[model samples]
Target: MLRLFLRKYRTMILASVFFFYLGCCLTINFTRIECAFKTSSKNELETRVQSLSKAQYVVIILSSPNNEPKRDAIRATWGNFVNNIFVENGEIINKWNHTRISKQSQQNVVKLLFVVGTLGLSGTKADKLGNEQKRYKDFLILENVEDSYKNLSLKLLNALSWISENLKDMKYVIKCDDDSFVRIDLIVKDLDAFAPSMNAPKLNKFVTFKEHLPTYKGLYWGYFNGHAEVFLTGKWQEKGWFLCDNYLPYALGGGYVISRRIVDYIAQNMDFLSSYNAEDVSMGVWTASLNAINRVHDVRFDTEWKSRGCKDNMLIRHKQTTSDMFQMYKSLAQSNGEKLCNTEELHRKTYFYSWNVLPSSCCKRN
Candidate 1:
């Protein structure tokens, strides 16, 4: 009888312990979930700007009044190319104007904002003495920020705010100049492939430049003037190449992409000092400061695409004529049909390069 009573007591004790442990686990999990929820809520304001549906891609170009001619030219060419090429392939192209975008479709559209500064004076008048007088407000001017670097910081903040307010549902955000032309089909394929690749970094998006250095003493490569001298330090010096990770804080030129999370973070926290020159470099610095990793892709940007032939697997081509942009679009649309001869040859040369290169020099040691 005593043995039976002891067995019952032991079973009850075991049950009590099991329940206690389970309760503790449930509490911990609930706490973690709450924290994640808060973080998501904070980031939602920015991430929600990404529209994932109207089309798979969003292209952003910065244009000024001076570039209107080029814009018109490119638009005409694209109109022809889209009609002749993309429509036949069943690929739909939608113009992402602020008014026409739907709430649901807006959520899927990528937001691209071009930040174009005016070069010429606006609204000038001759004074009574026949001397030319310029109006301050009419001039494209930077805010009076601390240093030149701070101007860019402020520009990004303002630009991002404009984007968030106007394009609340975009999925991606790209900032490019008027002279750049992206191979939309190639960019879409690359992003689609990159999105699922385990090798890609979860944080810090891609940045393109001539070179990078991590341990250099002065400003990072591409920080100063466009033609700044390249410094040598660390293993990169020996290899005669710059890595993106080292000088991310001072990146410049071409353009870059920002995921919704980072954009939201920046929008929420826009207290950085402004920089007057090289907004792109300041952006790199700002992103680096946020603990984001700026990655480098192998795609060639900011070069004459026509000279190299329009068929390369490159995601973007810089310094393009309006005609070149249209031609490239047409080529991509017809890629499924009889392949264009030049494009085929260009693809053959470019397909061997992989976008999976790592920022760390670990492999070099081996």
Candidate 2:
């Protein structure tokens, strides 16, 4: 009788055992796959951070989405070079050193990349931009903002956010337009000499004010304007929330340098910052509220509504044509960094920024 009962239930018991074993195997495989995916994601982020750490200074060039030629000119000119420092096996090496494949390394690269905005209308230029980015791997596209003259403030916002996300470890960040000409070597020389002094804001020991209370901290270096009147009606008017008779003091957008702390501070408060008509003005307004800020106004940066002429010592010059860029690069490269423009070409008369005069006439021509 026992043997007959076992035979009757044999098929059901075998089926139950097989199903249990199959379920256990599937569960184990799924968990392993999920863990692999997570590990891969984490590793990708770590790799990005490690690679980006090689740059001491990064220049974020604001470019137009459709202006591929402008970007190309920049690439062929001053923005073409790469000099990154890496530490491998307790030794310092450069990116060009192809001798040793470093298993473990620390990267510090000083490089430049273009930050462009999206084209809201069609996909033609957008597709081209995507392909260009893939080729160079140096583009930071702001998907939310449209690339237009009026929307530059938003473009700047997204650019700084990108820096905060990827290149936050860099010592300094320089923001400039695509048309600007940058003499990076000269700028680097000044930085090496005056970095500590640059970091410290000019404060008086006798007077205690909120602006000067902070010590050597946020350094904002560029050509600054404190008396730009608010225009109510014009092509470059301010209808935004910047309710002021004069715009807050800010470095001109052509080419300005900011310390890492400044970038971090801006990133931390990105969500609440107001949008202004001009990106430079927006920067000034947003930074006006910070407790610690060191504003360094230097005339060497020829960044303004117009160029202050071609001075030999100028570090940056805005409103350069594509042709002008090629010419400038050729002059500098051929003369071994002595001459600026061709001898035949006319150099504009240089002017000074009268900061000591009346507040209303701060940047007036002498």
Candidate 3:
């Protein structure tokens, strides 16, 4: 009787093992199939979506559906004000066909877009976003990806893909968060001086002069310096392991401008590039992977919780609320809108810490 019981127990264990292996095989197959489906869906969407034509520079504001007030605030203040003008005829024409009123149109070369992602399969959130898009006709929606913090990298890729496909002619593409406020007058003045004509000279070529030198074609301008470590665990860790120990020298995600060349490179390599959930860091990785990209540092793009002292000189200020945007615009107006603000603190490096995982070397306070 003991021998019979032992044989029966062995048979049951064998059956369980067989079933578990089969389940694993099925799960693996299902995941592959799901990934394939998602890839196809994204490809289809990419093909069907239309691109915005014209515009020398495109300022893409990464926003959400619920942030209508913030969007409106931007439009009311800096959004509506184009190139230091306050609007005489209430109509300024640029390449993107954005029919809005602002100050005098110096070059009328900048275009604004708010990018948002889908909420779910079918719900009020999705509906609200659709309605908002239709009403404004300014948002670029990511149908394949969900709108969540973890999926920001994918959202950024979607934007890059669209821009590459559609806005290829635009000289520079500035990726900004909804909360970040840009002094358009400053940006336009810089772009104009750097790349004034179609054959504008390319700046920032030498190794020693990258810090204060102006850049033109093939330039990746932002507030970033050396590499930061990729955390394998905790809040900062998601898919960071795909990258090496340190993230590549890329711009901060809050606000950075990528030249047409980088955008083209990103568009071409989107399929094979590993997706790290952190958009800014992932962008650094992407640029680092490519050999031809010219990564130039400009401290004018501020991404700090507490900004530096050069308020007037800031080209872009992150972590702004609607109220904050209004106040900044007012300040800009008072400071003689067109005169380039002092870059006294422009070269000063600012440090930001969201988690304690980052090393002292990641961001050096100077």
Candidate 4:
């Protein structure tokens, strides 16, 4: 009878005993659930991400004022998944009330926001964008930064700054292009699998990596370009990139992932960071100098200069036209998400980055 009673409350008894030992051994004790959450596995950072600390990930789309059609296409399609927003007849009826994201919603809550620049936006265009922001409440407009290809890096820095100042609770930030089609479900699943390994220490880029290498604490996942040549004078000319013979190896700008610490670092030090011509290149330079960083060169990210065609488990595909987005979304919906894309429709050769090779020879014909 005693054994049966003990067995019935085994977990609670064990927990109480374990915490009692902790209280004796440590200076602080679990007086309340808050302290327990701090010292126990109940409030592990990964646990928070898996359940609800705040939003685990926020997809920040770099957009232009003129890309309303592309934005609408995304909102109505892949970006409109159950995990994302819900818009009705071009207006955000916000089916999910804009309250503090509840613990239930945080399990897979991947929010979406567009980053636009207000350099030349005026009168009708500005008014239209204002109306759109009012309707959707999903835009981060960098008023000082110009919405141009040349200012993309600046745009990115400002966006990170905004995230740090405002939505700082998110664990991961996905910097995606407006044209890219994001696979949110696949990404969330992959991220959960990737979360247990996140145990790195404070991430600061200004602290030069000279002494012992800091054990990697965070993640930077994307398709990285190991070698990219510079243009001294051209449409892509960068007057500020004199750091090395080639630009620092950077993940392609179409879509990439960085942890919150990285975002915080950039946001905190953005005023002093240099803005190169390419936002991705700036990202490389910024993170390359960080205390410690672990990068996953995910081939699943077809975010190179162009798509590596359509693969089975792609996380995000860049250079997608508005039409392409609709078609792909339609196929996924019809197949109940079992079929990602029509293999017959997008027939391009697949390739991988040769990380084993030298930086200059990383990309090869395969």
Candidate 5:
């Protein structure tokens, strides 16, 4: 009887082993089938790329309301700057004001894409345009809010959604405030030289910020005065102000670039927060959470004309008066203080000579 039982047990074990091997074989086959599907999909993508035009186009979305003279003025300012300095002249850079969506002239564009918001749409032209534009599945609008933080947050979320839907075909997306002025020529040249490797996976290149706060419980609040607003709820006691710790890094506002992938990720994950004020900081935290590297490029991110103290030489300047903008552009055109305006040119020359370009080693004391 004992011998018969041992033989039966061995037979059962063999059957179990045979079935496990069969299951493993089936799984391996299915994996290969899935991989083949992916390869075919990749080939399809390659075919599409081969057929499409390969031109680098910069898309600038300037948010403004309708019939505002400022919108036209901003357009003029951008048009003049882009025409004079940028490499891809006429039709290469498409600048669209958010206010003119409803006009008969704008119907074609609104059909393609549209964004709506208070700052984005002002009068009848804008309202009609926005209403019509919203019919499209891709159209996005700013979140309605009475405060600056919520308003800007909604604006950014809308922009991110638009970018994700469009980035596959776009070369670059530049998001700037209405008040910000760009040196398009310099920007194009810089991007041309620094465009991340086409061979490697897409890289996330943008200005990153680091912030550090103290360990003290109550003493740690109320440090950030650069831009801070009150919260609607008292969930947390209103301490002094929260300071971006001296050691902690955080991205600065006024706007920054995001790679297509990063934009896609943000669009899918941006949650509605009640009290977060700094959009740039929020973006930095989000990107870092995804393990994406946030590159801190040395290009001057933001500057005011009046505060041009010693660092007048900057690639980009923000919050400049109209008169100051004229002066700065005129200075660049005239070669006054050659160092300030011609840094990009100088770097190009130095690069051509095969000499090492030194990193900019300067910091503004807050």
Candidate 6:
């Protein structure tokens, strides 16, 4: 009887060990499945955006939730500068609340959206952002991700994905940082005029790269140039992806406009592309991968101000202080071209020096 009891106990131990190993195997498999599901969900986000139909143009601004002052300055200034005057309660208001661009006669309608990600483990940021969104109705919040400097590329991917899904009908999509001042007035006007050129059978020779004839289809516009060893460095390094050589010709990241076709391409191919911590370099890599993409240079869209002075043709300025934004907005409101240009010129001289220059053959500001 004793021997029989010992054998039963041994059998029970074996069964317990077997089940433990089985549980471990199942847990590992479940983890992988969860990761794959997250990836697929991210990929499917574009499909969702595509289903929402497209718009004429979308100015996607990258902002963090904590940066309320910057966002407010933008909306109060350049955001509502174009065709945004309307009468509300017997008073003329320039705020987006009363100003309607959707019903305007112009085909180059521009919609503004601030894209942001959530803070980790804290719901306060999301709540604040939600309230802000309700008040402004212009934010595109990425709920699944955390907001961090390291996530700029991911944030961009989210922006492109969302734009492709919701605003795909837009002729052009402008991606700018919150600190950027986009001359929306000029941009809308120029895009309206340039629409016909985009639809033409052949593209205007706006920008040419390495003897490659320019085409209008995959137009990526910004202040572009050749830079040697311009890839991310230090903490922003891309790990396995080393750029021992010069960076391929690409736009500066502070702000740029891309056609709907390129947005669509990026939206579809996002899952397959490798991401770098530096959002701009990652953009360069993705565009470089596609033959159809063109790195067009236009001085007006100064992603990094290098001009000795701001001329009348200045369109976009980056890295402005909050005070500068307000001051610039006041100048814009006054339509004081001379003052604005002088201020911009002063800013250019103060912030940047001409270390390198692009060839004169590159595209001129339109």
Query: Evaluated with TM-score, which candidate comes out highest?
Result: 2
Off by over 4 Å in 1: 1-58, 77-155, 196-252, 274-276, 292-296, 300-311, 333-366
lDDT of 4 by residue, 96-172 (tens): 22234343433335678799999777789998997897687677778788799988988999888877766646878
RMSD of each: 23.1, 9.4, 13.6, 21.1, 20.4, 10.4
- Return the candidate ranking by TM-score, descending: 2, 4, 6, 3, 5, 1
The numbered model that scores best in lDDT is 4
Candidate 1 achieves a global lDDT of: 0.42
lDDT of 6 at 258: 80
Off by over 4 Å in 4: 1-53, 82-108, 196-215, 344-350
Q: Which ten residues in a row have the lowest lDDT in candidate 5?
A: 216-225
lDDT of 2 by residue, 259-282 (tens): 888888888788888878788988
TM-score of predicted model 2?
A: 0.73
The lDDT of each candidate is 0.42, 0.72, 0.66, 0.73, 0.41, 0.66
**Structural similarity to truth (TM-score) of each candidate:** 0.47, 0.73, 0.68, 0.73, 0.48, 0.69
Provide the lDDT at 259 for model 4. 87
Scored by Cα lDDT, where does model 2 land?
Answer: 0.72
lDDT by residue for model 1 (1-366), tens: 988887879988889999999999999999999999789745753443333223333445554434555655545433222122122133333331223333333323232333443323243311211121021111112223222222444555666655554554454565555566654433443454443121345312333332333421111111112222333444223222243324333333444455555566666666654333445645655555443233443324433223344434444456666766666656644654223223433321221112145323211210
Worst 10 residues of 2 by lDDT: 202-211
Better of 2 and 5 by TM-score: 2
